[model samples]
Target chain A: MPHDHHDHPHALLPPEPALRVKALETILCDKGLIDPAALEEIIDTYQNKIGPQNGARVVAKAWMDPDFKRALLQDATEVVRDLGYYGRQGEHMVVVENTAEQHNMVVCTLCSCYPWPLLGIPPGWYKSDAYRARAVREPRKVLAEFGVTLPPDTSVRVWDSTAEVRYLVLPMRPEGTEGWTEDQLVALVSRDSMIGTGLALAAASVIEGVEASNQSVEGTAE
Target chain B: MSRVHDMGGRFGDGAVLPEPQDGPVFATEWHARALAVTLACGSLGQWNIDTSRHARERLSPKDYSRFSYYEKWISALADLLVETGVLTLEDLEQAAERAKDQAGGSEEIQKSHPLSSRRLLPEQVAAVLAKGGPADRQEGPVARFQPGQKVRTRRLSDSALVNGGHTRLPNYAAGAVGHIERYHGNHVLPDSAAHGLGEAPEPLYAVRFAASELWAHPEHPGDQVVLDLWQSYLLPEEVA
Candidate 1:
């Protein structure tokens, strides 16, 4: 939405803050108070630079090993503990299993609180006010806007989180992977699958190229 | 013109930012870009006022404009915290210190893991997972009014400073009264910012206003603007 440049009562400031901040930042830069390189290194090592794809590798490993799947479903945090997928906003995680009876969706009515470790930073639309105000009022309509359709009777429960228990949706495994390997199954679990938006990676017979990134923080397994 | 605090003018102005993605690299990080516009505005000394409390809250017009709804809420909060005495300029400075320290040694800071950390425990996780997670905490109605109750929408400003010589919250429904047709459950306290308090997740009510009361056209005159406003925003009206 275009910001109204019109007069707002609170826009009043002492005028000195603007100049003060610039001079302070300049001095900090000159004195090396903040390291530009260090910030880059930190982001590369922790931020959106690494995610879902690494989790995809873990998911692939699990499909090849039943012991791992059991471990994944039971205690996902421990299961993927070694990968170090959890980050600033996603230190704590919850895996929601999608079954025949129910479906799950997530929202942070307060802000776009996402599980960035598994899923990358949320899309811009997720953070928009239209979604926040409308999602609660009419979720089905909102989902449709995202190009997803659900049965008329399917109840969509939108979870509005508050800096706690970030969520990831675990879709039910798809069919036709009878003799698939771990890597093959991992290839099937798309990012959308984890968001509970799309189904678990569809069968290879109809599978398309891996166009989008599917790196989940928790290491999703088909 | 709308009041400085009203947000009605926030409809499709084509100012929304693009999706967050790790591409050829925009400015080093996604958040930096996501908040770049707003942060720049904040640097410009542009800001708004707390309509609920009439406090001076500084926010950039760009951030104020481009921010998603919840981002606005959070921004408004940070603004109010600075304006009111709840959080001082130094408090945020200290909070940043705390955040930095917490970032380095978070293991000691968190007292108990939120429920998600212990999902292996079937019973507790079952409650959240089965119910699709916790319900939003809210406050219930104060009963100062009831359904079929006549009430007036209050006039409020959208910001502390005027940008275009216009306000965000117009007097469209100023002094215009309507009936409390529907009652949604109580919600989080709206006065948290004004009072310089943290949210307690209380209850509030949703009051409905006839469409005619807020706008010019009349589909049903009954078609209304349903507001999940805090009780503090409403006052008891006498029966006519």
Candidate 2:
């Protein structure tokens, strides 16, 4: 079904942006500087193949295999590549694990640099001036705003991604999911959890989050 | 030059509103195209990612804040295209005029001009994604500091006077004392790479700075911030 602008009057983006993008694309394509098909391919890869699901798979696998987790912690790029998640913004990977005494959070204060291959695109908030500025100064307050309240004893270690190396947070595996399969465990890993803004969903709450996300998906699909 | 892009330890930007967990990859069609164009041009190897970021940062602060994320990309793309001689302003103007005419015409007008160049095929996309750009230099200057070594970030009295180039070091972290957490090996220094300078690869380290060191008041005294600092940005802590 084609998206009719008239039908969805409240579309967040106006028509001007689309027109401007089309103009730029036309110019670049006309000059033999870019191939429209190539552009589409890149977009499709990020939209479909590369996303939080890939990161979730890695997290779940790490939880199930101690050796893999060790490798991931020591050298993330090689381990992630072994699982076929390696590309731009993810070439130099660093996985910071969250423990009972210390929590890990990732932020790019300079720019919105994220692990694109593993986590697809960064969310809007991650790129916002608010998160970029306050994440370093008052991470506990920022995390609390994301509904990620930590215990007073557990110190927050904010990883400011200031260089080429990309950082990913390895949230501790939730309790009571000891026997869960990798696939089931993947369902508990949300994008925010990996960013350290939120915690991994517990086994019981995973269903509710999944259902809520499904509803949001349906809403956007229309 | 203490650009707005170096936004660490600053305050009062507003609340980070949470979007739906499952949101569209792109908010609009143009955003996808903008991203594609940027990546497509990027694959040409004409410029590195650091250069592209510097192009965006070169924009005036007002223009930088006014444009949406992808708009910044498009603006930088245009500048890069012109600067690299890939496209001319006249060519873009003509194309814009043609696009305007096509928008008013029938669908056939849009289908008339087909892309002629070799498109980045699906197979090529896979290869490109697989062959990531690792900035680490195989052999370079040996690392100066080891883990657990105390260090302080070099403070530039006037950042504008520091070669007038973009730097990865945040203003907030400058002059702050920290402990070297790990040596991340040699990587291209972005301060040089962003300005068409040769890849002066240097050893980088993950430096751990206490929250109290960076801020006056403490939200959590136990908190700490770790930054990946390039070799050029650091100096050995002065002995008493």
What's each prediction's TM-score?
0.47, 0.89
| lDDT of each residue in A1-222, candidate 1, tens digit only | 333222321222112333222222222223232233333343343344545565565556655677876777666665655666654446445555555655555655434567666665466665666654444334455556555676644555444443234666666667777787767777777665565545565675324443222433234643
- Model 1 chain A is weakest, by summed lDDT over 10 consecutive residues, at A6-15
In order, the B-chain TM-scores come to: 0.43, 0.88
Deviation in angstroms for A200 in model 2?
0.3
Question: What shift in Å separates residue B109 of candidate 1 from its native position after superposition?
Answer: 34
Overall lDDT per candidate, in order of appearance = 0.45, 0.81
Lowest lDDT block of 10, candidate 2 chain A: A5-14
For A122-204, candidate 2 gives per-residue lDDT tens digits of: 98899888899999999888887888789889999999998889988999899999899888999999998899998889998
Candidate 1, DockQ score (0 to 1): 0.05
Q: What lDDT tens digits, residue by residue, belong to model 2 across residues B142-185?
A: 99998999999988612332365778888888889999998999
